[model samples]
Target: MLDFAIFAVTFVIILVGAVLYLYPSSRRASGVPGLYPTDEKDGNLQDIVNKGSLHEFLVGLHQEFGSVASFWFGGRPVVSLGSVNHLQQHINPNHTTDSFETMLKSLLGYQSGMGGGANESVMRKKLYESAISNSLKNNFSTILQVVEELVGKWSSFPEAQHIPLCSHMLGLALKTVTQLGLGERFRDDAKVISFRKNHDAIWSEVGKGYMDGSLEKSSSRKAHYETALSEMESMLLSVAKERKAQRKQSVFVDALLQSSLTERQIMEDCMVFTLAGCVITANLCIWAVHFLSTSEEAQDNLYQELQDVLGSDPVSLDKIPHLRYCQQVLNETVRTAKLTPVAARLQEVEGKVDQHVIPKETLVIYALGVVLQDADTWSAPYRFDPARFEEDSARKSFCLLGFSGNQTCPELRFAYTVATVLVSTLVRRLKLHQLQGQVAEVRSELVSSPKEETWITVSRRS
Candidate 1:
């Protein structure tokens, strides 16, 4: 008992000391009026690590501190930029390179090293982006085929059935990204299952290393983590080798194989997208379904738009542009759900926001949830209204954050195309409704999604 108590006290003292040591440099501006506010009341670290998820905590911080604030994350202080002007100042200039890679490494508790620099990654990045664009533009048959399979399975379910959307969407995203990223080799059921199992082992640890350090401290988890990574790397390398020897049909991996990047680099890139492409895309699809399920009017409007653009036919690439209302539903879903609630930039040099001076090497974050629901930018900010996007002005407000025209990532674009197809196909034939006596509470993991299984009953449209 005495030993355990001593350890606990030591841990708390170390934690407090670390927070004090790395507290923002502006802490010294005791009498200065220009520095951003801090949570000296010891609520700072708690807010960032709150179980309600970082998004909810950030919303509270922004509400209390206004446009700019600072909070402690362990020994590091993260500066939150909450306004449209503040967010634009960093993102608009695009000072950060490899933003996605930086986020991934930070979560994994790893550092960027040689051969992974900005310039070295440019060629591989272009190749991967071009492959996705070309595939979506010229070769969309794979996506259509996958959607057909998904619809057939859903139709086979009993009438007015309750479906667990998050699981199903994840499965759909896995099949879609795999077929696109790895090619037909993944179409093999066994191979897909093997890859998913290894992927899940790694994904289960996301955003955890930064807190518990389990990936490093726990021997069991460390071993499991290494095993999973090794299996995935071996799988990617084997496929890359086989494809290079045969010069088989073009795929994302094939494109990467021909690049000058090392095998390890290619493996890392695939791993990044494998985790990213699956979760975010799946969440977007599931959230849109949940929102539409609650609002019959939105469903009706979306169905009508679909019928006008693609009546009794599978969705095609050329038909995507004409489905304006469908696009609105998606845009509104991303905004309401706040799919990606935060983005960060590292300060290589000191910077200023308004009158405050930011110190060097600070991690500046864009609290996207706060901006997405800003009352000044979004009308009745919390209401889930698709009509808000009917005009070009709403999109111009910079409130859509990650889903906006200028802000989308490659995986987001791919997911949008997939999700638009899924929603269009299902909404035309069925009406989605939330299961009685049950509500889907948001679970803020690496991706924000339902805490419990998201159950939506689908009934055939009369």
Candidate 2:
């Protein structure tokens, strides 16, 4: 017993010494400024994980640590910023390609050295000039067709059958975006349906793994993510191959194939474009409906605006601009429920932000959710007021970075048109109800959603 006790005591002492030696004691030692507070004395990696929501915790960190602060994310030195001014200073078109490409590669699971920088640039330029540039104008008919199909489906739902608004909206958005990008309807098609089911399942698991800190070094999670991404790529590549064989040049796949890019690169860009547009636009529609339902006055006013402008003419593409109130409502929805809450960049060269010197290759994260909701920039930041965007004074700051500016995703114009049409169609014909026990909660990931299960009641407008 004495020998065992002695061994145990010595082991405990060695463990303590190791921890003390390994743990960072000061901000400078941690490669961060001293202004930011660290819980190094009491906190561990598990403590960081236990904090409520990752998004909320990150926001709090930025609040406590000013615009530029550092935190240890799984042993990585994560530099965070929450000001638009700071983001604008760091992320410009000239310096954003590396960070953007890194994220794209990670998301698409692309192999390095497969495509050179010059080829990637040429492909990006072709994608921008061809598919993205023509998306808004070219996809108008497709958007309308998708919206009409969705409206027709919703019109059949009786008053007793309260539709799951978010799911339906997501389905509609996914279908519309896929149809627009691929020039084929894949929403309910058997192969596409299975692909979506598997893709969503994998992403859900991956999200859980990330939040639980199990994604890092977890071979199972890594395999799951890779499989999901691979399946998505395979589906897209098959479609691209078919389109090529047919000499079809209607959608993004066609443009991608024609560009100076490999099949893998084309697949990556397609996946990014499709996923970005589908998720954000769908969530926006869901939130817009929720806001309109909760606020009767706003809904009535919006319905009146739609009626006055559209007047039962099925919301023509040309008439989208006239529905000013609908646009404001959409903008307010984006401001309140930021779809893309955080934007990240890596510093390429040493630069000074405010008084601090930021080193090269340092990861910088800008909290768009915090900045958009900052009281200094917005009045009654928590309120759902669409009228704030009606006046010219308020309109100047209306750019909420939904699609961002310098590193703006190419699909914004297409998303805007599709969202405008869908919202206008619904508001004109339907009166939505806030279902019992339905409350809006933000779900954070690559994009945001209204909690896990958000349901709203809809009835045809009299």
Model 1 agreement with the true structure over 317-348: per-residue lDDT tens digits: 88998999888888888778766666655555
Regions more than 4 Å wrong, model 2:
1-47, 74-76, 88-101, 112-115, 122-129, 133-136, 185-188, 205-227, 391-394, 398-407
* Cα deviation of 413, candidate 1, in Å: 0.5
Residue 131, model 2, lDDT: 83
Summarize candidate 2's per-residue lDDT along 1-462 as a digit string, tens digits: 000000010111122222233233322224454233245542323444455444575667677877667665433355666665665455422331433334444434455433356655544755654786565566677778888888777777887677787788878777777777787646456755766665575445533543344666688867877777777878888988888898876777787777667787677777767766676667778887788878888888888988798776877778877888888887788778765566554454565566666665454556666777878778898899999986664564444343423324555556667778887877777777887776678875556687766777678877
Cα deviation of 42 in candidate 2 (Å)?
A: 14
Candidate 1 regions off by >4 Å? 1-43, 91-96, 106-118, 215-217, 399-402
Predictions in order: lDDT: 0.68, 0.62
lDDT of 1 at 89: 56
Error of 1 at 369 (Å): 1.4
User: How many residue pairs clash in each candidate at the backbone level?
Assistant: 0, 0
